[model samples]
Target: MSDKELTTKKYWEAYYKNSHVNKQHILTVCSYYSPIWEIFISNSEVSKSLIEIGGFPGRYLAYLANRYNIEPTCLDYNSDLTQIEGSFMEMDVQHYHIIKEDFIKFKPKLKYDYVMSNGFIEHFKNYDDILDLHVKYMSENGRLLVMIPNMKGYIQFYKYLVDYKNLKIHNLKCMKLKVFEDFAERHNLSILHLGYYGGFPLGIHQKINFLQKIIYKLHRLVFKYFANDKLKKYPSKYFSSAIVGVFEKQ
Candidate 1:
């Protein structure tokens, strides 16, 4: 299938249905070690409202709601979001909403204080269209937080070695910080923070064979023992796990 077809609602629905649900909470994912968390905490204030675009099985959204006591909303094309809703409840997040609609057609009744998407926009061919939707739902001076896999670096090389098909689904060009900076400039959004984040992450987002699994494990060991702290402090575009941007509408 073409990249366009791969990013369609039908494709995503099927992908989510077939994939196992991640019951792991965001905190357990070592989020504090990454710059993404730092940017989030530094830019966010308590009691602000946030809407997560295309955030199905909203673990990250739940994390934000629980951590900051923020009202949260999750919007996605996926029909069954009971898992995500349950997560919110389990986390004791009282004020949260889940909208089962395509983000392209979603019209919010009120703009949110923050609009966010985790690994969402890179699936699209048109980065501006996806970003415009995020901007459309934000209140004036609201912040937009976007995080995408750093697929242009060694991660891309690793994916090419073991998960080329999965890599193809992502728009590698969108992973660049320049793309976001250009978008922010055109849209009159001030860049609060923009850079790569995290240590070398072991991306198991796709299925791999036995040998590939062993290699992945070895890589995880290497990163954990030697590279984690250094990379976390100075996340380079060549090896950092994600590219993150925090922008405020100006």
Candidate 2:
């Protein structure tokens, strides 16, 4: 499957249907969004306002609502998307230009302090389209936090070892900070802060508590024990399974 196909509503919806979008998943979204602080170092107060483009199940929305006394709106094409405690709505982000509906249509009246997303941009065939949308809706000096997958990670490299290497990861191509900086500049935005992390896919594993230590330990042990040593050429960290960037509209 190509990156475009993998990010389709059909694919994402199917995955959401299968996976548990529980508290652990919510924490994972918060973990990625929390890093936006690096973008606005001057802000003495904690984060308050935020907007999540692909706010599936409202996990990040919940996080923002619980943390700060602010409302976070979630927008997606899927009307069936889970609505949590925070503000929730369904609209095609890309086509908001046509309908002149949804939040973006009236964004001038409803600006935010920050804009955040996780594992959403790479799904698009091109980030340029999405970046423009983000730029239009983002407030001046408001921060944009984006998480793009870094395919060079061990998980992807290992697929080359197994037979599942056929899937193309085009999103990895634009994972560089340069790509983001270029986009931000084109839209008159600045790279206030940027970094790449997610070495071991540990971001998700961090959800497990000490009570689940035995389960996590056994799982790792099984892989280390039976896994091909040749496949383990990379260290525990692959450096770029995902890239997170925070930008401010200049």
Candidate 3:
């Protein structure tokens, strides 16, 4: 598909026009990232400034800001009707800055300590250029994070085969981890961490069928009761529905 047909201002404006479903999905996804951000804060000095390139109505950043008390900037094409109240869940949305502009052309007076996007890069035909744009505003030694739907992963592939109609509307590319590793190399960045998250058999948000959910529940019972803690945490490449990569600017 052409870049014009891909995710644009109009695309998102329409998507979030009645955004209750989208907000719920964003909250579900952000719950996973919240723990990851805690790990980042524990290891390094607190990140003073962070930005989400395509975040609109900024619920994800609001969740993070509430936990870490960091300054957040949401750069997106336009605003949505879904507003996350400052006091709603005790998040201080006052520090969150929402910028209505094209991320490619956005020039910040100050760089951010952490730059991120959730399901952002895959929208473009030239994703490598998008990655470049994401890293452009990072401070020295800052972290870069990108998360995308795993169209290549086993569980998602199964969905594509059976539930093609539901998946077709997103128009996502089958991006793999190697593409990100290559991007890091070309940009002179160091890969800090890379992994998959959100297993489909357990993650309800994948629109899993009833039979699969029942089987997954039974498996979870066995795994929880019979399996060792280490075995329970075993990584499965094929099961994850999303892939996350974090890189540091060199």
Candidate 4:
């Protein structure tokens, strides 16, 4: 199936319908243990106006709003964004806007200081088109942060074992840091940072069978006891769970 078909509104609707807003899950993502925190800390001087494309549940966006006191806007195609609004309210994020519209067709009057997407762009075969949308809505010198799950090596192996269907939607070719580097050079955007992030015990955010769960438990125990610190210190393309890029429109 094509990328478009794989990531249809119906698909996302079904996804959100089954997903509940877990405050603990959101807190964990914002915590220091997560590599996402590293990105936030590194870019501490980022702007006050931000928008997140495909930001459902608004976990990262809400965290950014709370942490940095930035105004946040969430643009998503799904109508289920009411749940995200509810989540924001629960998080005590009082000031935020949720736009229910296809990002490709979205035309905002005001540009954002930061354009961000987490696990968003890989859903498209023509990812440059998505990247262009990010740049399009960004103000001059604004930062664009794009993050994707690293499905290139052992992480891919684990994803295939646990969630093959979910794995099929992502464009694995675009997961490389070189792709972002080349794109930044071509688009005249300065690459502030681009690299693989996080390490070991892949984030298998999908349902698994009993045997698979037991195996994953064992895997976690082994990593916790022996390799957690070492793996985290040495996040490579093959071992890291995510690939992140921060670029400035110059």
C-alpha RMSD values across all candidates: 2.8, 8.6, 4.7, 2.9
Candidate 4 versus the native: TM-score? 0.87
User: How many steric clashes between backbone atoms does each model show?
Assistant: 0, 0, 0, 0
Name the weakest run of 10 consecutive residues (lDDT summed) in model 3. 81-90
Question: Considering TM-score, where higher is better, how would the candidates rank from best to worst?
Answer: 1, 4, 3, 2
Candidate 1: TM-score? 0.87
lDDT of 1 by residue, 1-250 (tens): 3444337777777766643334455567535634555565544454688898988777778777777778889988788777677767666787788888777666778898888888888888887777877888878778899988888777888778777888898888788888998899889998889888888867666778998888888888888889978998889898888888999878
* lDDT (0 to 1) per candidate: 0.78, 0.54, 0.66, 0.77
Which regions of candidate 4 deviate over 4 angstroms? 1-5, 32-47, 205-215
Q: Write the per-residue lDDT of candidate 2 for residues 1-250, one digit (tens) a residue.
A: 3444335556556545643445656666566545454454344466456667776666656655555534566665544443332222221111111112233233444666777777776655766666667765576677787777665656555433331322353455565668787877787777766666533332231234474555446545655455424323432324335666778766
Error of 2 at 102 (Å): 9.4
Error of 1 at 190 (Å): 1.0
Scored by TM-score, the top model is: 1
Q: How do the residues 176-245 of candidate 4 rate in per-residue lDDT, one tens digit apiece?
A: 9888888898789987778877766445657899988887877677776776677678878877778888
* Residue-by-residue lDDT tens digits, candidate 3, 75-106: 87775524533322335456567677777776
Identify the leading candidate in terms of lDDT. Answer: 1
